[model samples]
Target: MTNTQIVIAELPSDSLTPAHFKQTTADMPVAGDGQVLLKVILMSIDAANRSWMKGATYRAAVNAGDAMPTYAICEVVESNSDRLAVGDIAASEATWSNFVVADAHKCEKLPKVPQLSNLMSVYGIAGKTAYHGLISVGQPVAGETVLVSAAAGSVGGYVGQIAKALGCRVVGIAGGAEKCKWVTEELGFDACIDYRAPGMSKALRAACPDGVDVYFDNVGGTVLEAALFAMNEKGRIVCCGAVSQYDTETPTGPRNLPGLVVVKRLRMEGFIVMDWTQNDAKALRALQTWVDAGQIKVTEDIVDGLENAPQALIGLLAGENKGKRMVRVAADPS
Candidate 1:
């Protein structure tokens, strides 16, 4: 009868909070010609969601009075195109609503998995991002030391594991001691440094005595500066998300920019997961094999209900989540 939606009530000028979002109801959307009606099942909660509000990077800016944009896993309930049929599962660019209309050509038809959430986690954006960013851009070699920031978070955790599977010594930089312990003991990283602790440079030096051959940076500010200093000559730096500066009013950059980059001859490259669309199938196959072999562990932090999406993003930006965070909008079609 009606569709529940979460829209940006007001754009945040500083740190984001739940107050910035509002819940409302709208008439159910209908499938049009060459489009499909989708019942949203799972919505991804990412740090980029916060960054999108500030301004456009790879996509348009999220302005006030607009439905929050997200990549969602949905089930087609009504189809107006030959590309999809009723009960088909799809992944598409959708809003924070229980139901939506998406172009049939743009929606990706997904296979039915035992757990649909896997389509949002390991087999989805998190795993693919880590795979593409590391393999394509980082170009890590065997026996090298791979360092990743925000190691306990979604993408960073997988980056370290994938590097380890490739016979590289993996080290992580997380926020607290507990997260650092999890990164080392559970995720199979050789070492994990607590960036919040004092003497971070010394601790990083101690952890990476051989120097870092590759750095997968997620949180940009000081952690990036620290990793820059520890980088080996000709090391590769994969610039992923900048979680540290996403939700702030005044964001700072890593002061050791071109100077350290030029001196070390480090190959630093930034990328979005969409950049490797041609190799998505290849990456997914490799990820599935690694999952089957137990080389990469999938961790998901899911919150129930669409109304909780705002708090989920806020918590994620505050470094409270341990893995890929997502919101369950509706039950999977059984």
Candidate 2:
């Protein structure tokens, strides 16, 4: 069998489109020594995927003619090492392909869940990111006002919910009225401001009457600037992904940078989820407990078929997805 793959046909100078990617077939890969062949089950479609194309951030740059890279949940159909065996489910850094050969040592074996898609959502990068970025970086205390941007998207939604469970008053900033409503009503945030509406700064200040003690910023354009103006003294800013700037040719920085941060004594920090690898077990346990107790509600936006991965990412960047967005490549083994 041949492996179907999506490669970067051309790097986007501005906005990304389906024309930037090309689908092609290649010979099925063989598992070499200490490697395993994986059948991709789910591929995470994140804003980071677009940022990687601009240049390297935490990882290597995605050049033209290279298969688009992704974080994937896969099944080990062939193994050459003791780290994983055939039929084991694993999570790995994979490319946009039907089959991949990865070093067994790099693949993480995952526990079985009723819905394998959960492995790509709550139990995966999205939930872990929210848990670590909010609790560790944001360091919000009970009764304090916590504000999060992109509240309707993957990590931001979880950030708001996790803060609510911690007894902190939560507010969200999203693009539209519907999304803002979902953030407050469904995700349990105390209030949500539609950033697309007029007088965003005023609305944010009104929602966060106590002033924002912790600002979990996911989109880092105007929303971040607004949050900065509303921060209280000694507040913390968790710099997650910058979704607003990812899909454009020109990216703008938050206007009120070190000024607001310095005046408020705000602690601003940026992190990749991998930075807190040592705390994965603790984070996972907390997330699982919250999920079991119904304290954290999980939402997933899944697109079927590997060919639609490009559109999935484009839509995600356009604020079309409501929660954790992923592309389904294949069905779970029955």
Candidate 3:
């Protein structure tokens, strides 16, 4: 009967930072027709969550005072729909709560990973976001040089690995030396540039000496401008999520966008991961197979308790999280 949830309310103007989630409890909802009750396991702490907390952007503005928009992996505790049953593991949009009542249609049965605690990580929304953008937009060919910004983050990491698997040379651009080292040494990027370094444009040029063919952009401000100058003719740029400017009070618009797309005859497209909903199943299957075969790695930074969800979410925007950030709401013994 206990239901613990993380809620964000309007606080005093100046004190209302991203670290403002409050924990409260209420009576848990029972399963209804076409619904299933989920014992929340893992919830994503994403840069996107920070935007949602602010309540202005198109994606972040889920109706005022509604549960936050988050994807979580849960175990079915009760089911009124035949599609799911007790003990089935699934991924659903449960936000930041210990228990959730979700529509059966929105839940996807998870592939059981005996040794893994968060299969929903690489096989979840973050993985699918990378798969869809890289495959659909990047369309990388063998021997091409591909570039990725926010290279050490969730979707960016996947994009680099997938591109490398497809035979392209991958170059990653991250903000720090440690991240740059991981991108090159661990993720197998052919080169990794520290964007925070002096003369970053020169560093980027040196990394992609042969010219970039596919650019997967996660941090859009100055890095995007630099990418424009470095791309080869007919290059493709897949604009995923822009974490760099997500926290500013006023939105920071792109500066060299038009010229960048024009002179180089490049094709740049921006897309939301939800737009690829039709390909969700295929993407999940591919990611799962890759994980099983050791072809890809799923990195996660998890924080315990729903109470820490707000801080974890804030950490994501500030680039404090190394991989897919998550909040573990309840311990699922099953």
Candidate 4:
């Protein structure tokens, strides 16, 4: 069978446009020497996916003539390994292609849930990332003022809700007026500041008159700078993905760093959720509890087809997606 994949057609200098990627179809590779063949179900699109196209960081870049790197939910259709089976479902850090063949080491078996689509999103990497950032790093307390940047987006949405459920006064920073309304009205944030507004710092200050006790940041640069200035003494800053500066060749970071961290006595930590793998089960259980009690909700923007995966990633980097951004490669098996 032919497998279609989105591959890097040209190297991007600063930002990505449609021209940087191309769709290619080739015969599906066979599982060999302890490898398994996977059928892609759905793929998560992330801002970091942009960085991968640019070359060299924690994960190497997908240069010209290379398949884009991505994470996916898949079914193990054929296995040559003792660990994985034909019917097993898994989460993998594989390239963005219709089908993948790799050893068991790169894939992790997923938990069986009644609703795989919805539950996979919550129990997947996004949920775990939110848990590690909010509970592990931020550790928000009741009555504290919590501010979230990119608050209407996937991980940001969860950060605000979880902080609110902890009894903290939650405020969010999103791009547009519509997202701001949804964040406050539907997502339960006390208020949301449109960072795209004229006076962002002033608006955020008004939203959190008491000063921010916790700041869960997704988009960095100017937003991080603004949040830093709004932070109360000893406030916790959870550094998740920095979407704003991801596209730049020489990505500039937040200014006034010491003025906030040293003067404010802030505890700012950058984290990769995968580092906290041991706590994955605990975090998943907590997420399920909150979801069951109606304290947590999962929202997503899912696009269909492997051919449109490049556009999904493109839109994701441009802040076009409202919730957790994903692309459905095939119909989820019933």
- Order by TM-score, highest first: 1, 2, 4, 3
Off by over 4 Å in 2: none
Model 4 per-residue lDDT at 1: 83
Ranking by lDDT: 1, 2, 4, 3
In candidate 2, position 52 carries an lDDT of 97
Against the true structure, candidate 4 has what lDDT?
Answer: 0.85
Taking all chains together, each candidate's TM-score versus the true structure is 0.98, 0.98, 0.91, 0.96
Which is the winner by TM-score between candidate 1 and candidate 4? 1
What does candidate 3's lDDT look like per residue over 1-334, in tens digits? 7888777655323323554556778689888999999998888777776556556676547543565667888899999999998889888888688889999998988866762345646766678888999999889999999999988887888888888878899999987899998888887889999888899989888888899999999988888888888999999999887777667655565687787678889998888888899998898878878778777887777889887787776667767776777888877654
Candidate 4: stretches off by over 4 Å? none
Look at candidate 3 and tell me the lDDT of residue 301.
Answer: 77
Where is the poorest 10-residue window by lDDT in model 3?
Answer: 10-19
State each model's CA lDDT, in order.
0.94, 0.92, 0.80, 0.85
Q: How do the residues 243-271 of candidate 2 rate in per-residue lDDT, one tens digit apiece?
A: 88998888898876878888889899999
**What's every prediction's RMSD, in angstroms?**
0.9, 1.0, 2.5, 1.3
After superposing all C-alphas onto the true structure, candidate 2 shows an RMSD in angstroms of 1.0
- lDDT of model 4, residue 303: 91
Give the lDDT of residue 138 in candidate 3.
82
Q: TM-score for model 1?
A: 0.98
